[model samples]
Target: MEYFVHFLLAILLTALSYFVGSRIISDGVAIWQALIIGLSVVSLGALTEALGAPIWFIVLVPFPVGMLLLFLFLHEPLYTWFFTYLITLALYSVFHVIMSYFFSFHSLIPAWRLS
Candidate 1:
């Protein structure tokens, strides 16, 4: 259940990142296009996680994949895609760090995580 919820959240975050990058940081893309890009980029990480991969290793799959997909999915130049992906990656990192800092839950053992 934890993995399931995490995957859902990751999908939403991917869409949000695409939306922000294309719509706000650069020219707007179709919502459906963003969804496609997000789905393509995050699928590998989702698969790795589902296979019980280490968290640190799972963290590494999405960056280059997302950048590659961004360039492929959008008609924009590579620099635009790269820069926007960096923005998205930075935002994702900040969100993850902030959530980890405040999050107290741990596999149904909340206090166990603190130690």
Candidate 2:
């Protein structure tokens, strides 16, 4: 059940990322392209986690995926994609760190603790 939930969550997160990325890019980006990029990012994250890297490292996976997609589809310059990728990575890393910290903290609280 737990694994199923995680799988579902991964799917949802990937979809959400794709939606947001596509919307932001907005100039002829196809849904399938977005989905592919999103899935790649999520797969990288999963692989990193499986390899026993810290959660923070998993958060960095999206940037390269996004950059690759942008360079491939948007005709964007590689340097532009690289810069945006770094910014996206930093933003995601902060978000992941904050969410993980709060989640772990809440889990430690007696009311939220699972045995």
Candidate 3:
């Protein structure tokens, strides 16, 4: 059940990110392009994480790089992609944390809890 909820959250976040990017950048970006950007962002983060970079680097570096790629190659502006990516990451993190707490909490003791 929790996994399903998280999956849905991911889908929602991707859609929201695409919408925001399209709105801020231009209506020209196709749905496929937006989805590619979102997926690429996730892939970059995962690869970086697997390479042993700190988790913070995943959020900070990949977003800008992804936005730049989208802008330079895809013709979208940095403002649009950047803002949309940030919003998506923020929402995903928040929801993931909340769900982690709800589903993984082992005890009422705050300090003893683990995600």
Q: How big is the positional error of residue 71 in model 3, measured in Å on the Cα after superposition?
A: 1.2
lDDT tens per residue, model 3, 1-115: 9644544454445545554545564554566666666566655655675688765665565667556545654464667656655654565455456645777632111223347
Clashing pairs in 2: none
In Å, residue 99's CA in model 1 sits off its true spot by 2.9
Best-performing candidate as measured by TM-score: 1
Give all candidates' CA lDDT scores: 0.64, 0.52, 0.54
Q: For candidate 1, lDDT tens digit of each residue in 61-95?
A: 66677676677666787777777777776665555
lDDT for position 69 in model 3: 49
TM-score of 3: 0.52
Give the winner by TM-score: 2 or 3.
2
Candidate 3: RMSD over Cα atoms?
6.7
Comparing 1 and 2 by TM-score, which wins?
1
